[model samples]
Target chain A: MDNNIIRFTYNVDGTDFTSAGQASVMLKKNLRQLGISPDTIRRASIAMYEGEINMVIHADGGVAEIEVSEECITIMLKDSGPGIKDINQAMQEGFSTAPDDVRSLGFGAGMGLPNMKRYSDHMEIESELGVGTTITMKINI
Target chain B: MKITTVKELLEAKVVWGEELIGKHVYSACGSDMMSDVLAYVKDQSVLLTGLVNSQVIRTAEMMDMVCIVFVRSKVPNQEMIELAKESGIVLLATDKRLYDACGILYSNGLCGNGVRRG
Candidate 1:
């Protein structure tokens, strides 16, 4: 049988934390309708949700592309912001650059990237200081 | 345990999803940190937390949790309740503290979704 492929693009708004996880929520619904396994959907949604939040908190905004096929689901998030100066530092838990106000909102614990890495089967990050950041994550179905 | 049983066990007030009380939940997690919840990957259906905010509901939705229990007498506002309702997640509030509530559930056969570290 030929594999079914689906693709979706989301425009993330970084200024509003209230609307950050909308993309992931919608993607979860779409995946459920497509009959993906609950575990696969949860991992994909959680990884993408963390990426979405990072885009809003660190970057001004960003773009998310999700491609779903029989073999795997791929997510690419690109943001134009003050790129990560130290990738190692950013990856560490409890090391966050977020302002105190962001922490009050229940995020900015420096666990976003780490959670994304934990949930996805594979992950890649590309960034440049003052330029932008791009993260690619994939989960095998 | 069923969501209804949780409500009864904790003497929780139902904030939303009254219809979902009969739903079964095999595992649960209690935490104030959204990132910690995201870090642990499990098929847990219930979340018990003291943190009151929109992210709590968002995290539960992202994880596909069926219900949220607000511990320590924390009451969620309309916005948070609305978000939970939209996600079809049952919301409950209890006077019990986080540790006590988790213990009650654990003793009643609710397992935690263990954390994964590498």
Candidate 2:
């Protein structure tokens, strides 16, 4: 069996709320070109998009790394923001620390992390209060 | 329902992608929170939102949604229009409130159960 992997990296800009989902959008197009199934593409893009939006809203942006293989797709999101204080609490639906303004922009309903988990086949989160946070998710193709 | 029917039922003005109105949409959902919208992406082809932003278009695009109805006559910005145009997602604006717009469509047979167009 040949083990081949394609990788793509995108810089999430924390300053701009409007451009948050750009990476996921581009990734969707790329995956389409690779002839990935629409269902898989939708799941991966939605999961990555939630992560990207969270990076901008909570972590002041970060780096998103995507790895695509024949069997699965892996997404790694790393951020250097204040970090998640309680992973369990943050994982709960509708539990949000995002301010009032973000809600007006049609996000921050506290569904980001949970939605990422819901769409992916597997998910993991690592965080330190003062240091940073990293989230890894995988979807089986 | 075809996207053109959604436009007529809501009395919506086309913001972009007027040429693509002949497309058909199976199911529909209405929400301002994009995350909530993302949670229910089960073949939902039409998105009704009052929230105006580029991510709105991007969300519809990610879901493979063919149309977005902007309730309450809320107009999307240039960036949003351009984004929808780029993705070939039709954008429509209506003066009706979210609930009424959704109700109208639901009463007319468009549903939220992710039904397939027959």
Candidate 3:
């Protein structure tokens, strides 16, 4: 990691399903401009995208922070929604807390966390029942 | 297949990225479920869906897709169109239903990337 790395932040709004993936889009452009490989950009963007959607749907919106360095791209998502009761169950495919409305809009299939984990080199979830959840994912460039 | 060919074949209207008409795409997938599209990891560049939302454009953008065809007479709203333009994704709308639209493209050489399975 270099001291001169670029960092970006986004304030995700939860009220609009139509605006959920904005952070991922911006991050993709930033990575591309940084001369990261397309494969690396895709991995990081998709992981962050899923996390962004989760923040909007499950949490009442959140903040997304991206830190770019020589070694890896790290995305941190913090949300003040009801924390997951069981992280294990939430990680399962098809286990979603999103309502039927979200499914009709083309999401909430319960693959959010799984897809994030699949695309990133590492993922960590820290949550408290009533407090909130913070997810940190890193993809090595 | 060229995106222009897709537009002509489906009698579609372009909502954005007119300059991408000549771009080539080897594979495509049709689904309203963004998760399903994310599950399938392949070298796909076209997305056909009945779902009209900003997430659709975002999904295509993340997958590095060059074009998105909205089937079953679905039309994207202003926000979605703006997003697609900004992302440089070609957006097309067709009156053809999802199955028929996909069938036409498939029969004409656009192959599905095949969804992921556990």
Q: What fraction of the true interface contacts does model 3 reproduce?
A: 0.80
- Candidate order by DockQ, decreasing, is 1, 3, 2
Q: Cα deviation in Å at residue B84, candidate 2?
A: 0.6
What is the lDDT of every predicted structure here? Answer: 0.90, 0.91, 0.90
Over 4 Å off, model 1? A1-5, B115-118
**What are the per-residue Cα lDDT tens digits for candidate 3 across A1-141?**
367688999999899887788778888888899999998998899899899999989888999989998888999999999999999999999999899999998999999999998888899999999899999999998
lDDT string, candidate 3, B7-30, tens digits = 999999997888889999899998
Best by TM-score: 2
DockQ scores for all the models shown?
A: 0.69, 0.58, 0.66
Which residue pairs clash in candidate 3?
none
For candidate 1, the TM-score is: 0.94
Using DockQ as the yardstick, the better of models 1 and 2 is 1
**Global Cα lDDT for candidate 3:** 0.90
| Candidate 1: tens digits of C-alpha lDDT, residues B1-118 | 8999999999999999999899999899988888888887667789999999888999999877899999999999999988988889999999999999999999999999665654
Clashes of each: 0, 0, 0
lDDT of 2 by residue, B1-118 (tens): 8999999999889988889999998889999999888887688999999999888998898889999999988999898888888899999999999999999999999999753211
- Fraction of native Cα contacts kept in each candidate? 0.70, 0.80, 0.80
Q: TM-score for model 2?
A: 0.96
